[model samples]
Target: MKLQDILTPDCTICAVPAASKKRILEFLSSLAAEKLVNHDTFQLLESLVKRERMGSTGIGNGIAIPHGRLINATKPIAVLITTEQAINFDAIDHRPVDIFIALFVPEEECQNHLCTLQSIATIFRDKQFCKQVRQCKSNHELFQLIQQAS
Candidate 1:
């Protein structure tokens, strides 16, 4: 699927000041909650936290794709956040992470969730795309960059 298919303009954040992984997930959970119905923000955060406890989603090169499956979710949801400064995320490369793309998917849609994660990883793996995303000055620009990259 497409990034735009799951990401909404309202969920795109630029220059966020989240200093820790917990705070980042909290912010993303709240953002994803806007598009969900009958889902608690704490529950969403718990799902993401649980996944992170299993392993860090930080895929190196200043990017982190944190995702979790939710039983209450009817469809996939994405939230993109670009922090004002890089934060330590226990990344495999031991590099700070400044770009985050979070996904919340239905528990039953494992294949689709994996595909979406792969697509996002592929997009961010492009050095040019990462550079463009880093240069984005606003949420609109960041969202547009994702569109262009896709």
Candidate 2:
């Protein structure tokens, strides 16, 4: 699946005021829960935290893809956020992260999860694209830039 396919303007937020990694993940969980029916924000947060405990999703260069599986998810859902300030995310490169792309997929769709992660990684690998994402002034602008890139 494509980034544009899973990402919507409603799920794209810009200049968020999250001050820490945990707070950001909580914010993401709440946002994602609002979009998904019969989903609990705390449960979603647990899933993301569980994954984080295994390893940080931070891919460095101010980007982090925090993803998890949900038994109730019927399809993949993505949320994109940009913080006003970068926060420590325990990234492999030890750089603070500001851009976040959180994903939730059906627990059974392991292959789909990997493919989606690869697609997101490919898009974010472009330094110019990451720069454009960071420069976005509003949620609509950020969503538009991602759609245009995809």
Instruction: Provide the TM-score for each candidate, comma-separated.
Output: 0.97, 0.98
Error of 1 at 95 (Å): 0.4
Whole-model lDDT values for every prediction = 0.90, 0.94
* Candidate 1 lDDT score relative to the true structure: 0.90
Q: How many backbone clashes does candidate 2 have?
A: 0
> Candidate 1 deviates by what RMSD?
0.8
The residue-level lDDT of candidate 2 at 30 comes to 96
Candidate 2 — which residues are off by over 4 angstroms? none
TM-score of 1: 0.97
Model 2: weakest 10-residue lDDT segment is 34-43
Lowest lDDT block of 10, candidate 1: 141-150
